[model samples]
Target chain A: MAEVDEASKPLLRDLKAVGKKFGHVMYPKKSTTLLRDWDLWGPLLLCVTLALMLQGGSADSKEDGGPQFAEVFVIIWFGSVIITLNSKLLGGTISFFQSLCVLGYCILPLTVAMIVCRLVLLGGTGTASFIVRFIVVVASFGWSTFASTAFLADSQPPNRKALVVYPVFLFYFVISWMIVTFSPSHSDGTTDTGP
Target chain B: MSTTERNKNPNSTESWGGFEDNPIQGGGSAVIDMENMDDTSGSSFEDMGDMHQRIKEEEEVSEEAAATEEGDDGEFLGMKGVKGQLGRQVADEVWQAGKRQASKAFNLYGNIDILRPYFDVEPIQVRNRLLESLIPVRIINFPQKIAGELYGPLMLVFTLVAILLHGMKTSGTVIREGTLMGTAIGTCFGYWLGISSFIYFLAYLCNAQITMLQILSLLGYGLFGHCVVLFVTYTVHFHSLFYILWLVVGGLSTLRMVAALISRTVGHTPRLILCATLSALHMLFLLYLHFAYHKIVEGILDTLEGPNVPPFQRIARDIPEVSVALVNTTVKTISATLQSY
Candidate 1:
């Protein structure tokens, strides 16, 4: 009985860690959660899921076009890596992963939008579905940009806040494009912002 | 963290939250020990030092728990990453040298010791895993990694590619071989891995917990449907056939992919979401197949139309002659029936 109790402790600890991270994501009012004891697990997961959802024409050969998970995976990771480099080069105060954590975790709203879009698409995907999807994606795009910049704004050097925010905007915009154009060939969860 | 999961059965996918942990936590077996965790690993930064200390600590805890004798020996053999990294190279070499002998003495299966981790209650069924993966009928049963096979999907993919290449060659399509191979392999494998990873991501989203390989096996089998579409183009060659085939293959695979995922889904909305997504995947795959290879039907017709002979004339030449008496008797019977009417 004692051994069984001891065996299960690690599992309980892991649950607590995930719950705490989720709390921080749900309420982006603090940076200490992601800033101080940074771990890539949350970011990596959100990145993979978002990449999978946004899988578009990037992976296809020239003729039979569509994005591959590899392309989305590379784009998201490399995109963030480049942004991290830019921030650090400009003498940002935060570590690379902390800034990355901010960018990655803020994608939660967009990810949820993807899920909702997928569900809305279940009814039909004509002009109406496109409109619904556009609103949701626009809202998510706004939310992601705002949240990431909110967290990362302090990390930038005083004069170069635009420089940091600009790249962050581009990064999220690229992700949003992937989300908007996603057709769910596996039935994408997000809606088409345009026809 | 993943080491335990690597040993863990698919049954444990329900609570996948703890997966993707700090990879530092190997030798997960010795984690059962409660005491001496601090004294051994307190100074060391490496996870191996923690495991080595935990294994030593297990000896004291063994008096009460008494089940981890094999767990200690299996660590050296399993966590190969730790091979040369430990502080004492000479002692590590000695430990390496004794691994096989140690495994034989302590593990349940002796030399076949890797099996100890999986500890199956039911027998390993390779045939079931293979057949089910192709059609995805028995989804309630979690796919056992030990029993999973890639040969079926791999072969079907190869055959479909080969058939498409052959069709293009015979039809005088002038695409370069390199480009053809690149496109075929890319679409085949890209779509396979892409869609599987997508479903995996979806399952993760809905908390439907599944192993990566299980999802791979489930989606890999859809290649069989692609092969079916290609095979029918030969004898019954027609450009319009794909429309009907899409309905048949897409609907069936949708049902199968959904049923397979059913056992793992968390609830109603997820079920509906998965059903829509899976059916949509099937629809896309069928359409992709048609785009890539529907020309094969026309190609087959082109081959059959050899040198001024339409297919009807060529086939007509193959018919054996009919007797005049038989023709006359059939005409007389038809005339009598018309008179009676």
Candidate 2:
């Protein structure tokens, strides 16, 4: 009982410290605090929100063969894990969870772009709507890539930084491609595939 | 002394002393004297008189001090009473403080000289900054205060002129249909104010410490891009390239300004989200104008003519077949696996 009590005291203190760190992450600045004391809840919450956005976009899509909910969640989870592993293999100083956190939060812009593209599709499928969706997806893709790189890029070795960034770039590009291609499912089984 | 002797003597002070000396013999007269006396005793009455005199002197001194105080400060001269003066002074101080805050809110509009390059020259640097602002990064030193102020008014004038010109081009007459011109101008201004106010509300929700003037100025500068488009269209042919260029410039400038303003308050995630949403709205506005004002209807007809590929799709279609097949295969496999669940 005494040993457990002694252990619980330090654990409680550590939890309190982590709680404060989480507060800082909620209103993140260009500071190192988020990277210093990484937490799971922040990234998990963000991933769930991203998943919800993906699901919402799919639900509104005109195509019948869009990715399901589980597919999106799996893709995001596996994508983050793959990127984190790649980042580690490249001798990046950041840990697996920290990389995951950064990558997951970075998905925010693309998720927002997806929701917006879906909404724009609702108005009409004119060339103007396509242009609007294109601009949004491109801008958000760039933003997501930039935001993630701002945190993860510095952790990489100086010489191999470009190599590390390639994966990150490709990661966001794939997501943007998916968002751009997503369309609402029709009542019939036929899908309206974009060129 | 007897009561009658005291009354007849007419020397009341000496008689009172005599009565006090022979208390037993003049007991009845002393009782009557006590009854006629004032409620207060002699020593107490003297003390009360001294206190009243001191209080009157203090009042006069305070009045002099207040008058001198009011003289020292010219702002309180109009007030008649001391209380009125003090009250007015407090109110004046509050009013001055409020004025200082109001001035701070409008401080961006003060120095117009910094924007001289925009008017006198091409303002290449400012234009470059406008493009750079779209990057959603922290800019340590933006010459937004002065340049933005000048941009707002200039943009407003350009917008008005553009609307008038568009009216002239469309209706074939400006002076004949005065009400139409007036309505168009009113609609333009109303839309400008409405969109600016909406952006301000979004900034507020983000807890960004941005002033209304800053937002209005940024949006005004954005309108300057549209004015360029209008001028080009009016003078030359309505080319899609120029229209697209306007969209790029205006959209980027507005996006950069918004991102810069809210970068400090919101995190990177929310900031990018807001930027995307706002930029999307800007594109929608451009599309609306393209259809409403230009009446080109090319995009609409494209949509109607078979299953037309969107511009984005056309660009996507240019990618190598291998990468496209790879992405499709990966997505299909993953989705196929998840379908069982």
Candidate 3:
């Protein structure tokens, strides 16, 4: 009776904290406390969501997409790690996971864009649907880039800021591009969508 | 925090085995850890013998509680060994412990036993020292994060549950009883819902005006070929009959759909493309089922060795099996090094 702090209790707290952090990413202002201490919880949650959506939002699949999931998972994590290491090597003030936190958290806008793109994609492989998805992806891609750089750029030295932002730019660009270009695989050989 | 409570629950602290009745451990070592007090009294370690005795007791407790709970790091006594600030060894030890505890709490077993490699297999979240990973992120460390009710775990659970139903069955009626009935019921609704929705979406894309009910009833009849194929393949089994039936049934389904399109007078070119595409989609689904569960439909169940590989086992085969011996040796060395007890 003396101890109310049980396992389930902190989990709730942590989730609340995670939710709060997500809010911080949503409205990115000089939130370096976010930079000082960050958890991969939000980032990972976003990563998993993006990965599944990329593979077709269908829960039941007939494809062996082990490689595809692994492909997305590895690219995101490794890209962030390399970006983080590069920042650290350049004497950026941020720690490894703080950089990871910003890099991963900023993926939020892109993730949303991917969801919208996937749903719009369901409207079929026509020019109208394709144009709608393009605008959404481009808008969110810009938002993601702006938000991530806005959060990350201040941490770098004035001259080296471009160096840091470049990778971050590439990182978001690659993911957004993936969302843009992805097409569901058709089984029949001659059934390719004609240009 | 749960960290303190959990740490104490696994108090499997044998050094204090004799001191179980001591006032410090009397309250089941709940939130207020008496060990934290002992750890703070850092200056006085009553020499090597006392530490050895505590270490020996801890190992025994670890073995006992390991079958149930995961971490006893909350009962961790490494604090008494280090005096003021953390030593280099203690720092690394603390980092390693934090990583291990975090992984266990998240249900993430990395590297050697990469069970749920890419995504979180389990949806439950336990707040432990998990947020703080002190180890250097060297070249993509093992998959370590998963949360609940999301698509990664949700789809994984649904697909795994559907497949495991096949895994548990070992009998003479592997196909007829095990897969065929499941396939029939599943394809009846799933395939119907799937194709109709697909066609409706495709119609919208192609600027064809067709009502949902019209498409649904059309596609419902279109499923007759697949239903017939299911029963025919059920009774008479042939190796090539599967693919051969794929062409025939797929064509029939397409023809029925095209005939419905002709009556409706939607358009000319779109009808031809729609029928051909539907045929291709049907072929795709049949090819997937055949290739996915290859051996189960080989006509006579008596001739085959046993049940065919389950869908997930086929997915599992995609992961190159790591040798058990290598895993053991690496695990042994890691445990031996991390055994600060």
C-alpha lDDT of residue A93 in model 1: 78
Q: Which parts of model 1 are misplaced by more than 4 Å?
A: A1-5, A55-64, A185-195, B1-341
Question: Model 2 residue B144 lDDT?
Answer: 33
lDDT of 2 by residue, B10-92 (tens): 43323233222223333233333333222222223334554455434433443444454534342232222235546668998
lDDT by residue for model 3 over B14-84, one digit each (tens)? 23334323343333443223344333323334455664564455444444444344346533433432332
Specify the poorest-scoring 10-residue window by lDDT in model 2 chain B.
Answer: B310-319
State residue B283's C-alpha deviation in candidate 1, in Å: 42
Chain B TM-score, one value per candidate, order as shown? 0.46, 0.41, 0.34
Per candidate, native contacts kept equal 0.00, 0.00, 0.00
Model 1 chain B weakest lDDT span, ten residues long: B311-320
A1-195 in candidate 1: lDDT tens per residue?
Answer: 999989999978766775687567666774676677766777777778776765533334232223456655765676687677656655577876787777777777778888877787677655567677778888888888887777787876666566566667766765665566555432222222222
Where is model 3 chain B poorest over a 10-residue stretch in terms of lDDT? B126-135
What TM-score does model 2 achieve against the real structure?
Answer: 0.32
Model 2 Cα shift for residue A116 (angstroms): 2.4
lDDT of 3 by residue, A23-97 (tens): 776777776767777899989999999888776632343432211465567668967986776566555677667
Q: What is the DockQ of each candidate?
A: 0.01, 0.01, 0.01
lDDT on C-alpha atoms for all candidate structures: 0.56, 0.54, 0.53
